[model samples]
Target chain A: MTAFIGEFNCKLDEKGRLSIPSKLRAQFPEAVGNTLVVNRGFEKCLVLYTKEDWLDETAKLNAVDDFMSPDIRRFKRIFTNGANLVQIDGAQRILVPKKLLEYAELTAEVILVANGNKIELWDQAIYESELNVDAAEMSQLAQLFHQQRNQG
Target chain B: MTAFIGEFNCKLDEKGRLSIPSKLRAQFPEAVGNTLVVNRGFEKCLVLYTKEDWLDETAKLNAVDDFMSPDIRRFKRIFTNGANLVQIDGAQRILVPKKLLEYAELTAEVILVANGNKIELWDQAIYESELNVDAAEMSQLAQLFHQQRNQG
Candidate 1:
């Protein structure tokens, strides 16, 4: 498992294809082979995972004990059923399904991709507007990470 | 908004109550006054957000035009319907629904709270298994962020 961290901004072409950063692309060679799973992320972003990772994730979701709970049924319906397996073309691009593109508010224009353990794609304006990071808290964030690194 | 970034280890009692870090508590004054939303996050973690943020997020999901395609229906069912909103107690603790805890593979012992734009509560072992940083790709990730940050 590799840590996929950082942020990226790029264009989604007319056909809805966006390039995966080369570095990140290298991490998925095994499971992706050719196709990757792209799905809705928590915020206004898209999440991409290799086929194997997707299967592993969905298996867990499927293993939920009871479908009686609305949450479990809903989780199965949305996360599991709503996923799309797309292939990365020669240009390192994957076609963004129309529905997913709309969900993330991404157009053919600029898109922002943030690296978490998962990849999150967002519309440039919405990403900036929704991300409420404040300069005043920079030191606190830095300190927190510093402490974690020290503890680790 | 106060940035709550880092890792904090805490216990989720038998009753499903876990203490919120003081640093994170300071960032969600409104949530303290009312309720917050906790939902399933990617990477076997639970995501916590203020009511305002949750509403904003769900509204977007709700707006997905299900009439457009089968994918829309799937998205609506999973992302929107699976979500749960819980109120925080005076002690800054919220009950983790048994189902959600099970999804994240949490037990009575320890949980790891990680800071992203939102907080992710993860089982300690799962967090340890999932936390692998790729030092070899740091420069590439940095370059991507640099390019994106520099543009506009």
Candidate 2:
């Protein structure tokens, strides 16, 4: 299993292809090869999951008893709503699906947040303004975390 | 790999223990056994990853060239800032760490959004009020997704 970390400043070409940072690329497991799954994130960003991880996700959806719940049906539909399976070309770049590009509002500049199992693609401005936590808040969150951790 | 789907309504017992929905629990890969990793999410919620999946995440973090960027260092600190490891007991329940529970504001009622490789635990009221997309938005989102998927 491969879990990703770090944030990289990257760019999308005029053709809408974004180059994967080599350091991030190096983290891809052999099982994932060149295939990647791109989808809308819970937030207004995009998520990149390795092909192997994507398969596991699909298997989970497949196990759902959809008929038993409309929420499940809707979730299955929307969770995979604009998902695209892309391959890294020889140049280590992937064509951002136009619709997804529009959805995430990606332009020339983008940021790749290599979160655990998924990579988040965000417009640089949106990422900085929306996702960046202030130092005070982070300190509080960290303190709360450590408090519970020590208790356990 | 195991992917999860659907949202399940649940409750936190007096002891702050949450029972994993049997359906969702069934989705856990055998390799995961009873171990789980709980951490603060990018959003104001808690994220649960299978132990196997968590290990993969750590592996990615280990590969990072931290000395190259201060951004990476800060991200690493906040990303796993409040991470905790817990186990599902014989009753299939895991104790939500006290501080994490308070951080997420999870009280009696809770909602579990089993997304792909991880599960997001949110306060039911907060989830409904903050995360629920109205019908019009869902339709628009669906249209955009289908258009992009078809283009490929």
Candidate 3:
């Protein structure tokens, strides 16, 4: 598996549409996908997953034995309730559903980050803040990502 | 940061050079990254991180406070001890250090998997086995990743 890599700065137009950089879009492996699923990410950012990856993720979420487990339910609901099928148009742009745009607090400018399995869309300032880490704050970040990843 | 995506079937040449697929290479924002760090990943695979991502990963690993913590020590050692600075050649191939090849049990054939922050190099068969996840294994995977991440 080749991870999608690199970061790109982009914009959200007045209609909440985003133009995924062609540089980024061109890496899609047809076997894993060209289709995409947009949904809430672990953090405030929005996550975009290839359709194939989405199925793998959904399968994991589906493995939760207790459907009534609050963590499982909340996690599933947050993901599925907000999940939207999307595509980059001929112009290499994708329309961010109004709810998704709001979920990520995206304004005019945004940063599209490629994390291993998905893409995280963050408010530019927030994205910058997240990456500007220093040594002393290490432990704090450890706790932060831990809590965030487990927030369910 | 871009999460690496897609699975690629590749090989470790007699000289131990791994040719990163052109498709994946095309995703890099730069003509070629100035630096790369190859290290031991939590799984039985070798991880290749762009210098920028390695810095972020190091920041997280640096959070471990107790040198006496065996788990933390082992995790840190795996990453640091195996970490090697490498360059991708003009032909878009990287020389896999002999030690790393042995560490990941790479034979003539291998697979490069794109993970969010890094590329995982695995012996082809091992990679396939690792990916054959079943429902009962989901919780186990969740636990394994949690423990691995917390070790730092």
Give all candidates' CA lDDT scores.
0.65, 0.80, 0.72
Q: What is the lDDT of residue A76 in candidate 3?
A: 75
Give model 2's docking category. incorrect
Screening candidate 1 with a backbone cut-off below 3 angstroms (N, C-alpha, C), the clashing residue pairs are A78-B78
Rank the candidate models, highest lDDT first. 2, 3, 1
Per-residue lDDT for A84 in model 2? 91
Which window of 10 residues has the lowest lDDT sum in candidate 2 chain B?
A: B65-74
Model 3: per-residue Cα lDDT over B16-123, one tens digit each: 988889998877768337457687666679988887777677566555532234334333333444456567898888887776788689988888888786788889
Best by DockQ: 3
Candidate 3: fnat, from 0 to 1? 0.00
Q: What is the TM-score of each candidate against the true structure?
A: 0.44, 0.49, 0.49
Docking class of 1: incorrect
How many clashes does the backbone of model 3 have?
A: 21
What C-alpha lDDT, on a 0 to 100 scale, does residue A106 get in candidate 1? 91
Best by lDDT: 2
- Residues B1-152, candidate 1: write the lDDT tens digits: 22233345578888888877664566565534757778887557788877676777677767767788898788667766547888778887888888898888888555434332356677877755553225444444434433443442
* Model 1 vs. true fold: TM: 0.44
Q: Per-residue lDDT for B69 in model 2?
A: 44
